[model samples]
Target: MSEPGTPRTQRLRHEAETAAARFPALLAEAQIIAASVVHGTHGRRRPGSGETFWEYRHYRREDAASAIDWRRSARGDQLFVRETEWEAANAVHLWRDGGAGMALASPGRPLKRDRAAVCLMALASLLSRGGERIAALGETGRARAGRTGLERTLHALAEGPGSTRAIEAPELPRHARVVLASDFLDPPETTAARLSALTAAGAEGALLRIVDPAEEDFPFTGRTRFRDPGLGANLLFGRAETARDAYRGLWREHGAALGDVARKAGFTLITHRTDRPAASAVLSLYQAIAGLR
Candidate 1:
């Protein structure tokens, strides 16, 4: 029998409640940041004559008879034709690291997961405003757009799969854009393989590496205990300062390797610390996605 409140299901439910409570603020902040950077411009990539509704225009002599909307034309004295919206709806697949490692953050800083969610949602808001389809990778159902899309993306993020392991390649369309936000602490080769597979499948995207200030700074000195979140393995350092140099070196090399892999795979990588303003990262991510179109 499982404990009343400590069972995995109960813990997950509690987490969902916590995230739901924070969802509004996250959404609002993302909207504000997206607005500030994107302004009202979305830079759509779709052609002028797509299949979505645009407007009704008076029929032109050059227009084909089949182009006329007979029902609309009958209601008005003048012949009228229906035109599709000029905006294109490009597909953008978004994913965030859901590992136990992402749960680590210093006391006064947001969790890496929170920061990643903000960037993902904010970028989605900006992209939706520009008429793009937004899909949360690994979630069921199709990509969405506008307010509905944002809502779906938020719900999925707050309540979906919980794991830190690299995400499997989800099926996407040719030339779609994918945005992955994560702590990216996984092994370099694992990260590289996932990226290469996505590229080979024809989806171009940006990677946002969310780092906690503590992890980046390694401010702890003297005896300190470090535990791997997923493995439950602990390492005790008598003088943590002694390990600081090597730690920093390894971190730098890890970052460089991620960058090299991303470049080789033809994807863009952006690093954002949880303590910094999220707007900068959001804006940069938006520009990168826009550039792909």
Candidate 2:
């Protein structure tokens, strides 16, 4: 077994491969969910259904019997089937926040933001494999397909120092689908407004808010140092019991506010904790995106 804190170059490659392998199963489920939703630009054709016909060629042995057009058959030496424009794949934008807050480590297992990155990358791989064009963006800027784009995206995310820069909403292409993976510790109002703008511009958006189990439950006890990962500021904390209620209350309030804003903006919000398996969170996000279609 690999030891913790091993050189990321050696260890991360194996991890990325393992996580990428899980994408196929998750995508299978996503396709099933998408089948019942409204058809969007990202949707694939039913193989024989649609109107704006695609080009036809000589019929292949595996061509569906129902796809043969008798009229076209009469005029041609060979018969072929038509595909609809709607069946063509659409582009997907996988935008992840690399801000400092996202780098905070959970008490155990994968760090909160790192886990979210993995989930997003896996989901992106699935989308790309399904024929959709995928563009991945971090806080600094965006990266399109590379020799191994999915792996590169995952590596970049894991190695990122986290964003010190303010969050800005990116202008996406019309009819494009976006998946944002972030801690969302920034001002809820600003974040909400950015998301609303994206929606207004004809882009569909979803948020995966990553949180640490410790932050959610406030399990800290005795005098402890609390540090701001983004700002690099630290403060000494007293016994957890004394401020437990207040901390929990504030956490809940923040979560509620974030949820409300996301709902009002017409974006799906999925909350993920560091302690949980990323697979479940990825599945939930896929389901939500599928629902939007």
Candidate 3:
């Protein structure tokens, strides 16, 4: 009943389950941190307040006595609860790059891209459990929810050999937030411009740069054969120390340039190494985006 290579799907399911087990604690931490930030508080308004509270304000213009914070009034004269409308639940789109470069296996692992997909699925599950609609976008876009939807997304991500087309700007609602997961081995300007377009369209986005440790450090030494998995090509290179300094410098510069692009576009950028625990990276990223830590 299952096709060959479908085991990847099963692996994704297992990873998602493991991630879900840890999500409750992580989310709790995220909430506590988010509470300290203004945007976080605004994003987590009470759902029932829409009908009951007609407004919020600085305790001005004949405000109702019941609505006033008497304790705050004792401390300051300018306390008010202005009328604020309840915001509707928003959706999150998780876009993953399944291109060949992303498929490069970690030195000792089967495939780094597979692991990244699992992480993305776990994150999507966490957000979905928090009442946000979750959608998966890759070569094609699939929108679903709940456990079943998450499974479907994982399966789709695992099946894709790689993306052949260029990254295109997604059309999302003005208030939508996007979580883009990719190694981003593509042209810097092209990727940066695409992300910028998302921000320009009134949607906020976060970039997750999943990288293999080797890519970061160029740890290969002596006579080594470097192969391009996506292109099916191999090349021999000399000792790592020969160009290690220049390579590291360029790598650091690349990261710096990406950071600049993200800041300029008003998006958050997080880089994660495949060798580390994905949960740690995810938690750090959530805190950064939520302005908690």
Return the top candidate by TM-score: 1
lDDT of 2 by residue, 191-223 (tens): 777777667756776889988888888887899
lDDT accuracy of residue 253 in candidate 3 = 84
TM-score of each: 0.80, 0.65, 0.65
TM-score of 2: 0.65
Q: Where does the lowest 10-residue lDDT sum fall in candidate 2?
A: 36-45
Q: Sort by TM-score, best first: what order?
A: 1, 2, 3
Task: Give the Cα-based TM-score of candidate 1 against the true structure.
Answer: 0.80
Q: Better model by TM-score, 1 or 2? A: 1
Per-candidate Cα lDDT values, in order, are 0.78, 0.63, 0.60
Off by over 4 Å in 2: 1-89, 138-169
Q: Compose the digit string of candidate 3's lDDT tens values, residues 111-215.
A: 566656656655654555554455665433424446666555555544543353423655443445667778777667977788767767566768888888888
The predicted structure with the larger lDDT, 2 or 3, is 2
- Candidate with better lDDT, 1 vs 3: 1
* Top lDDT prediction, candidate number: 1
- Writing each residue's lDDT as its tens digit, candidate 1 over 1-293 gives 56667778798888778867888877777778777778645667464446877567677564578979999989869998776543222678888778889889899988888788878888887787777878788773446667887788876665555343325655655566889988888888988888877887677889999999888789999999999998999999999999888999999999999999888888899999988899899988988888887
Quickly count the clashes in candidate 2: 4
The worst-scoring run of ten residues by lDDT in candidate 1 lies at 158-167
lDDT of 3 at 133: 50
